[model samples]
Target chain A: MTIDWNAFTPWSALAGGALIGLASALLLLANGRIAGISGILGGLLARQAGETSWRLAFTVGLLAIPSLWLLFAQLPPIHIEAGYPVLVAAGLLVGIGTRYGSGCTSGHGVCGLSRLSPRSLVATLCFMGAGFATVFAVRHLLGA
Target chain B: MNKTTITAFAAGLVFGLGLLLSGMANPEKVLAFLDLAGNWDPSLALVMAGAIAVGLPVFTWAKGRQKSLLDEPLKIPTSNDIDRPLVVGSLLFGAGWGLAGFCPGPAVVATGAGELKAVVFTLAMLVGMTAFQALQRQPQPA
Candidate 1:
């Protein structure tokens, strides 16, 4: 019930979100593709000719941007309380789930919702509900 | 590189920067937002709202176009039916997100920062994705 006002950074968050939206908009306007991280990454695995280049280019950009940002600003400190086993399990779940679900937060939550896609809405709700339930179970019931 | 490739690269760069600036690259920030029972941070809500606000109009414009600016056919998904795979997959993805507080985009961006945990998580996620692909190739029991 308590809000962490001290940790809250709405301005930056909003700015970043706007940047994300801008990125998606640009991609759609330029390439007509959804900025879905999973779909982009998954396509790389397929190794389809003519498709691999752009995916690789996009991923390389994703990897390179943060490194580039370090020159201008200090990257935020990362904190992960979960152990390696839990992290691996969670990673696996996310990978499989995003593939099966057809998209993740970016594709479904941002782009899909923006386009008013009902499937994206359902997918977003399910994932968000699951996130809430999982957090509640882990933090409250299991005390982990 | 071609214009399409250049565009993809630019989009990825912007997206990565957005993720970093939004505090999403920090797992603690994400976990705090998800921790509705404990100390919840609503910053992510603002992030989503801001993204949607800008995206809505753009998508509206894009919907009417048959082709991108690059002259390629627009490939937007048209399926609206909420199927079992969609629900189950989203549920599982949400659980993983809650458990680790690192979705695919942030995880990849974090890996770029040379975080060992992100490296491990990314590897595991690739393994999981590969496994899903293998599963899809198997024949269903009749």
Candidate 2:
């Protein structure tokens, strides 16, 4: 398989990843919480968890990022490949799956792996394997 | 806002910024990374490694602690049992990710940027989550 050399951006990827770690670290060290975005957002739906204030605050911050970034520099361009139907279906799967699994990429992938949780490792493997398989099916087999 | 809330807000900001900067917010970039047979972009692997590298030490330290610096209880999950639900759910999540290349964090961030497709995905995701919640609230068969 040929490598996509033009798309490589190791430095920025590393830096941005470090920033994510920093964010997770800050949440853990300061607030004693996992920076699991899905968990945070899902908790809001429940509401009886009594962690509304912090969750809302975190969400507000996320929603405010574009406006905030525009002040400093233009945010990088985002390209979505899926049409509305695929996006909706995919979104449904992600939303339902994350809740059922108890974490998403952030929770299980980065933080769970870091914490040396076997469950997270298994979860990560399952998801990653599924991801690879799905892509192979879509791009190669189905040829969509 | 309390310190915890403020700290959470700050973390959210950093996390969103990181997603944007790491190119994870761009579904096309993510899809390229996922495309193993086609032209592969290995940047995502580096991103995960970089994140885990920085996270490892901090989490190791946090794992030993009971309370955070802010005096809040450390909220690490203690469940070690690998269940069917976990595996199934994770596979589903991955399928969705591979299908759309937009996960929760990046999707929300993109929605914030007023991307119309992102808006659709985010809304659909919320509906999906709400559907899950509804299912969860239903009475189980005795």
The RMSD (Cα, Å) of candidate 1 is 1.0
Give the per-residue lDDT of model 2 (tens digit) for B1-142.
5788899899999988888889988998898898989999989887788889999999999888999999999989999999988999899999999999998999999999999999999888888888898898999999
Q: Residue A76 lDDT in model 2?
A: 96
Give the C-alpha miss distance for residue B123 in model 1, angstroms: 0.9
**Model 2 global lDDT (CA atoms, 0 to 1):** 0.90
Q: How far is candidate 2 from the true structure (C-alpha RMSD, Å)?
A: 1.0
Q: Which residue ranges in model 2 land beyond 4 Å of their true spot? A: none
Q: After superposition, how far is residue B54 of candidate 2 from its true place, in Å?
A: 1.2
Q: Residue B112 of model 1: what lDDT? A: 91
DockQ, per model, reads 0.86, 0.85
Off by over 4 Å in 1: none
Q: What is the lDDT of candidate 1?
A: 0.90
lDDT of 1 at B47: 83
Which residue window of length 10 is worst by lDDT in model 2 chain B? Answer: B124-133
